[model samples]
Target: MTNDPLKAAWQTANIPAHDDLQAVVRARGGHPVMSRIRRQLLLEGGCYILFLLVYYDFFDGHRRPLYLNIILVLSVACMLMQHLNGYLLASSALKGPDIFRSLQQKVLQLKQYAWLSVGSRVLGWCGIMVFFCTGITWTNAKYGLLAGAIIIMGVQMAMLWQLWQRRINRIKNTLAELNG
Candidate 1:
């Protein structure tokens, strides 16, 4: 009688499906971090758009050479696109047909995004510097200011790259665990 009741209880227990488990595992891909990053990207993208709207008047884009204006616009647009890409990437929920395959796909996507992020940062930095320094007659103080700005930009780039690498490494470690 005791064995019969215990078997009945065990048989009646609900178990989640494999697909449900896969969905849950994929959902664990940095929900909070993705949300926060997406929000930030939205805010920054908006600001960049607004800057583009007003730059001609406020920043004398009209006075700058055609090439300089083009460079600034292209750089800002590239950065904006990268920001949008980041937001979309974060929202991606599909892992793949299988967990390992999905993770491999994710790693590939992240590597591409990392390159885009760094490349856009460098391009935008260069574009802004060229646009702003175009008409300036080089002086000692101006040279000093430019040096300082370059140093600051370099540090910022290093920090951002480090952050990207850390996120990538975390995913790689997870993949390693699965593989091992």
Candidate 2:
């Protein structure tokens, strides 16, 4: 049978369907896994720009204070670790079931993503606090925080939107098959 256009689109985008995803997990050959890993790494690498912005806004003005320097270093490290963990999780094959086998894994992944989002926000807040405390006098702190929150929210929303679209398309396809 010819594939559904929506399924084709999803496959082209490398987002696997429920059954196809199981095959993808079992299949042991090809660049698809590596490509996914690379994509995630690229996404994670985006935090560097934020780091630079924080550095320029707070550190470049005057001699860096000890506390600010330490916090900056810790923030960068935490961001890196958070992204790396997410990359690993997303790249790995879903063992056993396509979805979580137990409530634990589901809760764990949710908590992991939540922590990453919260950690990012905390890092941004730290940058804002440092800027204020160091007498940098910047107006962008509130806007920056809002933008960061929006980004995190967007990630979750986009994932859910894709899933919802996929389900609707799948149901339409099944109906068409039954009618035809």
Candidate 3:
């Protein structure tokens, strides 16, 4: 309200009103945390798309039961949708009102995705089990398939847990620093 000449001069100048300050903020690169989150989201989103391609190639027109195929495709689609949504959320955070609020939203988004990862793992395991039980009969060769599936599922779950923990902790650490 008072004395700075620069403030007085700026107040006296005729400047066009901005429709949204977000555009001005966005003209500059956003916060570092947002950049990191965006990169992670893009990488994961690309992986999901790649997974869908591979799944389609491997399973399409196969002897696999229709229900199993449907479930697998739907599951992949759901996972992809989640990743895409996360990516959009992360991108939007860059345009948020302030750095702290942006960070808070990013953390919330990461946490939500971490929980989604757990759900994705559970859904995958259940889908595999259901596929085996309902669609495939137990045969001599099927034992290998069952064993391989179990090993792969175990590895997948372990990796997912590690990834989830790492991502969540990274964001939490950033939040802690910001809060402190």
Candidate 4:
């Protein structure tokens, strides 16, 4: 009854450690999608932090409206939270036991993460929009920045949706196989 795709893939690849299944589990956690997510979190989180530091002047004075300041900061905070959740999920997946129950738990965590990611992206973008709308008097640059942000966020949302679908379906199928 050894119909496990991971096992089959390892055998087909001549990985030579079929008895040490935990190594295979560890290797699976290093999948490209997880790597991409980690890199994205690091890159975006770093850039956002840098942007805040560099633009602290714009946010600090008595000139800025409270709501605008709050919205702008909230947008960055939403992004940070989302990235942190993703990091935690990826780390947990790696630590999970090499068993069907662990796989099931990972699938559930992934489903939760997919929803959280979508919701956070929406909230973050909405905050950005509100910030731009409220701070129109602060700078004409708001319009250009909003437009660019929309395009970037749109592309990112699409990528995230695709990744979510691919990973979720893969895990669901694996779970189904284990259950069936």
Q: What lDDT score goes with residue 147 in model 2?
A: 70
Q: Ten-residue segment with the worst summed lDDT in candidate 1? A: 25-34
Candidate with more favorable, higher TM-score: 1 or 4: 1
Clashes of each: 0, 0, 0, 0
Worst 10 residues of 4 by lDDT: 54-63
The C-alpha local distance difference test score for the whole of candidate 4 amounts to 0.78
- TM-score of each model, in listed order: 0.81, 0.45, 0.56, 0.65
Q: Which residue pairs in model 2 clash with each other?
A: none
For 82-118, candidate 1 gives per-residue lDDT tens digits of 8888888878775788888888898889999998998
Cα lDDT of model 3 by residue, 1-180, tens digit? 759999999988987555455566567776677778778777877876776677655644267667787777676666666666666765653547877777777767777777776677578557646654664557988888878877988888788878878977887787788888
**Residue 104 C-alpha lDDT in model 3:** 73
- Model 3 reaches what TM-score against the true structure? 0.56
Q: Model 1, which residues run further than 4 Å from truth?
A: 1-34
Candidate 4's TM-score: 0.65
Which residues of candidate 3, in runs, are more than 4 Å off? 1-66, 94-97, 125-134
- Model 2: per-residue Cα lDDT over 1-180, one tens digit each: 246998777667865677786677558653576667767667666766566556755556347666676665666666666667766765555454433243335445555565564556466456645544664454798668757866876676567556545644564555456556
Name the lDDT value of residue 88 in candidate 2. 70
The segments of candidate 4 whose C-alpha lies over 4 angstroms from its true place after superposition are 1-37, 58-62, 93-98, 135-159
Candidate 2 matches the true fold with a TM-score of 0.45
- lDDT tens string, model 4, 1-180? 367999878777855564467577566876577688889989999988886676557644246687777777888788789989988888663335667878877878888899899889888888867765653565568668878878988888889888998999998888889888
